[model samples]
Target chain A: MREVILNSYREAIRDRVLLVVLAFGVAMIFSSLIIGPLTLGEEIRLAKDIGLGSILFFGLLIILFIGNRVLYRELNEKTCYLILTRPITRFQFIAGKAIGLFLTILVTSLILGIIFISYISLLTGSLQITAFLAVIGVIFQLTMLVGIVILAATFLNPFLGSLFTIFVYIFGQMIPRAILLAKFYKHLAIARILSIFHYIFPDLTYLDFRELLIYNNPIPLERILFGFSYAICYSLVMVLVAGLIFERKDL
Target chain B: MLATFLFQRSIPPIYHHSEPLAFLPSGPMVEVTTAPLGPISPEIIWLAAIQYYGEEKISGGKFEFLTQVFDVLTRIDPLFDHAYQFGSIVIADEGRSPEQAIRILKRGLVKNPSSWIPPFYIGFVFYIHLRDFAKAGKYFELATRRSGAPEYVYRLAAFAYKKVRLRKGSILIWSKIYQNTDNQTLKEAALRNIRCLILEEYLEYLNKGLQRFEREKGRKPEHISELIPEYIDSIPTEPFGGAFKYDSSRDSFISTTYLQIEKIIAYLNNKLHVFKQKFGYYPERLDELVAKGVIDFIPPHPLGRIYNYRFGRVIR
Candidate 1:
């Protein structure tokens, strides 16, 4: 399991697409310095928002491009066939690949986060601890996304898998709004269906702390604790489900 | 190079431009489309709006889509206070649409209920752009009630209240500021406002009494005291450490400080008239009055202005 995780991590790190995404993320953060001062004294806030936004956007891109292909590449190249014949079980393979992709995303996002935090401190002449917490929120959101990608990769091709993951993420973020809309129109049946969907999917909005960074507000300790537990639990369920499907497949 | 230059010149010189907000979907459609991106959509739009405004300012072009851009931005990010504030300023000043600016600010106020800044900006738009002091006062007063409002909000409320002739309301706000502020300058300014408000009421009362005296007696009163029993109950004391005095020539009462200055001007003109009558021509300058022994001495202007003889008139 350890060797498979390391090998997958090394492959993802060596991907040229990862470097391009990271470069675009850094460019976006640097461009905020020019765009932020155009606002009426909201320079620091604009920078913080754009910085965190770049982290979330580029992290999602990494997941879509790399995490979406992590499994399909192994199967298409017959690498999984070679590995599955060894001592590693199918669940270990699935879990190890998910963890490796997640680590790549985590490291890439951390690099972007460090640059953003450093840039913000240079602009404000002081460290922003809230910026750090907001970056963590982005990481948690990407963790759930990587899980969804892995789950989709089990049955769908790379293109379809990416599309599915994107739809699920968008729908997951809109779960609260969907529930509210359902209740607003007084559609009890729709509300019940949305409630079930809400229970099944990860709510990406829960892990979005950009507002806290934008308004310089503090996140409560309980929310951080809840977000941590929810991301871990959701990712574990996704990986286990994908493992089950892969275990039963004839490939 | 020559071909490129000629081609560029051949192209018609662009005389007009609109902001890129024309590409935006309607509010609900935009919300549905950008729902995937969440807050990033609004942030991107806000940056675009700022750049458009800056370009308009540089080029001195009318903001054709300023209201539209801001409307779209605030619609997506309802709690974006800076967008409301800066957008309203550009719309009001550059777009020439104060009403639309106020509309955006009011929406911000509703969405950001806990924020005092939106209401403060609403008051500013009403006061500066619309010149509707009553509405300005109402918004400024609302702002003062919101948490985290600055002390200056009270001052603007008082000023706006005064413009609408709500003297009591104005004085009430000024008194609050005076009582609460620890800054010496602000405290002094509040005190001055209170004194001026009282002075305004007193002057209005005295002027009304004088008018009544003139109507009833068919002559202006020789003194303000004469109007006490007939017109006013009593003469009010001056607030600026000066007594009120009657100016029979103008048929009005003025504070002593102003009367002193008016007397100096009147004396200089009187001397000029006498010189014209005696010499059949006016002196070329005020100094000639003293040169020709028309008066014993020239009194200095009380307002630190040099009196000049201009075209047979004593002017300062």
Candidate 2:
């Protein structure tokens, strides 16, 4: 599993898309710095807001573009057979790949985050712990995203897998709201169906601490603990499900 | 290259003859749809709102959808303080909807109870635009209670109370500032305003008592304390430590503190005369001094009395 994870990481890092995404993300941060002064008096705020946004967006690009294709390409190219003949189980392979993808996202977000935080510090003449924590929040969100994409890639073609991943990502964020809406309009059947999805889907809003950054308020310890616990468990469940599907495939 | 340029030039520009923010979804829908983007979504929408406001200003059109655009933005990012702050101002001053401005600022207050800015802006709209000084004083007082509120908000709160002739409320806020501030200058300023407010309170109390006594007895009271048990509960202590006197010629109470009130009355009457000279008629309202740029704000009468505009003169 260690070897597979390292191999997956190396393969993902070598992809040109990673460089393009990182470049775009950095460019976005710079653009934010340029536009920051134009947002009236909210210079630091706009810079930090746009910087965190750029990290999340480019990170999502990497996930949807690379993550949904990596496992599917490996199976189609018979690379899994080469790995499966060794000591690695299908579960270990899928889990390793998901972990590697998460690491890629984590590193990518950190690189963007450092530039963001450094720029914000330069502008404000102080270190921004809120910006740093917001980056951590983005990393947690991407962790769940990586797992969902890996699970989708196991069952669907790459194109459909990416689409399915995006759908789940969007719907996952709206899970609480979907349930509320269903109940609001008095649709009992729809409410029941959405309630099932509520448990099945990870509520991504749990990982969003950016709004709390505005007040410079410290995010409570319980909330951070819950976000970490939920992200890891949800990703583990996704990898476990993908492993089940991948283990039964004839390929 | 010339053919391509010509083709581009010949292409008809897509003119938007539609209203701004017309296609914006409801706040709840925008909230759910933009939920995935987190705070980024509001920033984008806020940029769009700024552009829309600029275009509306340039085109001289009513900002028909200003409220809805900001509503969606704030709903998506409730902590988006700039959207609430800037948006409410544009909605009130340019969009001409002080009520909508208050609603948006109030929404911001719900999300950010610790922030003084939203309440301060709400107070400004009430005081400057709607001229509802009581509500203005209420919100300004709320703002002064918040953490990190500036000393100016205390002054604004006191000033707003005085605008509505609520001298007691004005005195309380000024007294609070006088007690809390470490700045010697501000302390002195607050102390001065408090004394003025207190003197105004006492004069009004005595005058109202004199009126009630005259109304019942059908004759003027010879002494200032004659109506104590019936008209006033007690003769309040004079603010200047001087005794009140009954002036039979004018049929009103008098004191050394009346000197300050007399000066203010003379100044306002002179402004009224100037307005009459310039415009050939007295302003129907005293705030016309502010509207005509002769004064930044209507000066509060020292006796907590509303100035009545009559026949080219201001009488308190």
In CAPRI terms, model 1 is classed as incorrect
> Which pairs clash in model 1?
none
What's candidate 2's i-RMS value? 7.7
DockQ for all models: 0.17, 0.24
C-alpha local distance difference test of each model: 0.79, 0.78
lDDT of 2 at A12: 90
Candidate 2 docking quality: incorrect, acceptable, medium or high? acceptable
TM-score of chain A of each: 0.96, 0.93
Q: Name the candidate that leads on TM-score.
A: 2
Summarize candidate 2's per-residue lDDT along B1-316 as a digit string, tens digits: 9999999999986534225479878756676777777667777777777677765544334577889898888877776666776777568755778899888899888877888878887887787668789989899999999999878788888889878445544555557646654434335545666666676677778889888787889988767668878888887777556566777877777676575667777887888788778888876556566667766666555433334455666544
| C-alpha positional error of residue A43 in candidate 1 after TM-score superposition, expressed in Å | 3.1
Task: Name model 2 segments beyond 4 Å from true.
Answer: A178-193, B1-20, B164-316
Residue A163's lDDT within candidate 2 is: 90
Single out the weakest 10-residue window by summed lDDT for candidate 1 chain B.
B300-309
True contacts kept of 2: 0.48
- Candidate 1 per-residue lDDT, tens place, A191-250, comes to 999999999888877787776777755678898889988998999999999999999988
Q: Quick one: how many clashes does candidate 1 have?
A: 0
Instruction: Give the local distance difference test score of model 1.
Output: 0.79
